[model samples]
Target chain A: MALKPLGDRIVIKQVEKEETTKSGIVLPGTAQEKPQIAEVIAVGPGGIVDGKEVKMEVKPGDRVIYSKYAGTEVKYDGEEYIIIKQSDVLAVIE
Target chain B: MALKPLGDRIVIKQVEKEETTKSGIVLPGTAQEKPQIAEVIAVGPGGIVDGKEVKMEVKPGDRVIYSKYAGTEVKYDGEEYIIIKQSDVLAVIE
Candidate 1:
């Protein structure tokens, strides 16, 4: 099953680092204060949300940095994804 | 000094219950999960915030119920108040 976000929300999945590291080392991401990086999987049509005008800026396949505490975790078809509003996205990674 | 909220934000102070109850019993609000009731002290101008058009609805002296965890606590002149977005307010008490 595919997850389709509603409103100004978007679904994103953490972009896993390459498993083959140059030093063959793996560092877990839980011990840092850095923002999370994820790839957008689905984009919602933006309009009026909560009486506010919202325009969707990110699209599917775009890498983005989002607020640390934002987004709701949803499991779909045994795959985990985060659903967050466009406002929660801090920036797009070029 | 007075606090001036910005961008659809509002400064509110928790409404203190009457010191004397009919039964002379006092119950602290922290023990419950009920939404907090606050009185608006300052209101910001409705404008664009984070790329979204926001219109301020509540005014000073209005009583409102806001999202339980949606405000920032600020201490000014030894008085405590909460600053939150207007969207955080769920309802206004008539």
Candidate 2:
């Protein structure tokens, strides 16, 4: 199922948390902290300001990094999604 | 001292975390989670997109709510500031 964000909101599918520590120790899901990486799945049209529409810079299919605790978590189609404003996105992965 | 943000960036001064709980219980600083509220102090001159500039909808002095972990923290003049994108702002207080 595809979900579209309204005005300037972006929906992101979180990348699974790393299962292993840098030392190669595996961590169970219950022990994992919040995931900070995501894949952009949908984007909203630019937000309106003073009667002018602003367009977004990022697009769907982009890999992005966001703050671990940023965004509102929502469940859709049994999958977890994060809804955030375009500005909440820290950077687009190159 | 005041700071100016570049294009599409906003500088926010964190609103001190609630010192007491709703039930009148006081929580210590170490027990406090991250702060999610802030006041807008500076705003960037909208981001450049396709060579056109997008003006920001928020301005200085607006009370805003942002994701708890949404911004880059910086310190200047003994004050902490968070720099975020306009999109990261969840809402503006009237």
Candidate 3:
């Protein structure tokens, strides 16, 4: 099944973290904070909310940063995904 | 000092949790989950990000829901406040 966000929500897939940095040094997993970066898969349409127009800012293929503990995790088509509100998205990564 | 969010960030005031339910019975604070609802204070100026234009959805006086683990807490003007990215805000309460 495909995942789609409703209202002001968006679908995200967490980006994998590298075990090593650019210096080719291995870092312990416990020493590293979980990365909050993700890639946008689907975006919900912006509509009237609280008598105000809510517009979508991120689009498909855009990588973004979000809060570490934001969104609901679910497994679909045997792959893990997160569905969160568009407001949960912090910044789009270039 | 005034708290203003930069980029796609926003300022929030966490809503105080009621010690009692609607039935007017006092309950222990430990029995209640931290309220994720907040009131918007200052909003960030949405600029260019990853070739997209970000917009502010929630305005001042708007009540919002956010991730419990989201945002940074700070004290300003003798009041506590949180600064989080707009994406950290889940929904706006009507």
Candidate 4:
């Protein structure tokens, strides 16, 4: 099943953290906080403003950096997906 | 000191949770996660869209609901505030 966001909503899939630390130390899930990094998977069409459409700056393939705590996490089809507005995105990664 | 948001940025002050629960239970900080509720304190003038300015729908006095994990938390002048884009706002409380 595909989830479609309304307005300027975006769907992102979080990047899983590495199981082993840089020093080759295995870390458990409860060791520390979960990583919040994510990859943009889909975006809604441009948002409507004053009878006009505002195009988005980021695209589907763009890797964006957003607020670590900025989005609603939802489990769809047994996969975790985050729904955030375009404005929540802080920067685009090259 | 006042925080001025640039472009579509918005400044919000988180609402502190009550110390005592409804049943008069004093919960510790570690007992549960912190409440993510916030109140909009200030908003940017407007957002630039397609060479035009799109006026914001929300205002300073409006209570807005946003993603639980959305926005960067910043501490300024001994106070905590969140800087998020207007698009991060999901709904307005009437």
Query: Which candidate number would show the highest DockQ if scored against the true structure?
Result: 4
Off by over 4 Å in 4: A1-94, B19-35, B49-53, B68-70
Writing each residue's lDDT as its tens digit, candidate 4 over A1-94 gives 2545545767787655562233243323332333344678777666684446757787776766666444565443457666677777777757
Whichever of 1 and 4 has more DockQ, that candidate is 4
Q: What DockQ, on C-alphas, does every prediction get? A: 0.03, 0.03, 0.03, 0.04
lDDT (CA) for every model shown? 0.67, 0.64, 0.64, 0.61
| Alpha-carbon TM-score of each model against the true structure | 0.45, 0.45, 0.46, 0.43
- The A-chain TM-scores of all the candidates are 0.78, 0.70, 0.75, 0.69
For residues A1-94, could you state the per-residue lDDT of candidate 3 as single tens digits?
A: 2444545787788766562243243323232333367788888777743335689999989978776443565444456666677777778767
- TM-score of candidate 2 on Cα atoms, chains taken together: 0.45
The fnat score for candidate 2 comes to: 0.00
Give the TM-score of chain B in candidate 2: 0.72
Q: Compose the digit string of candidate 4's lDDT tens values, residues B1-94.
A: 3888887778987655562222122212211222234578888888675466666766787655455345788998889888887766654434
Tens-place lDDT per residue, model 2, A1-94, is 2445545777788766563233243323222334356789888767673335757988888978665444565443456666676777778767
3 versus 4: better TM-score goes to: 3
Q: Determine the iRMS, in angstroms, of model 4.
A: 11.1
Q: In model 1, which runs have C-alpha deviations exceeding 4 angstroms? A: A1-48, A51-94, B19-34
Q: Residue B72 in model 2: shift from native, Å?
A: 1.2
Q: Cα lDDT for residue B75, model 3?
A: 91
Point out where model 3 deviates above 4 Å.
Answer: A1-44, A47-94, B19-35
User: Would you list the clashing residue pairs of candidate 1?
Assistant: none
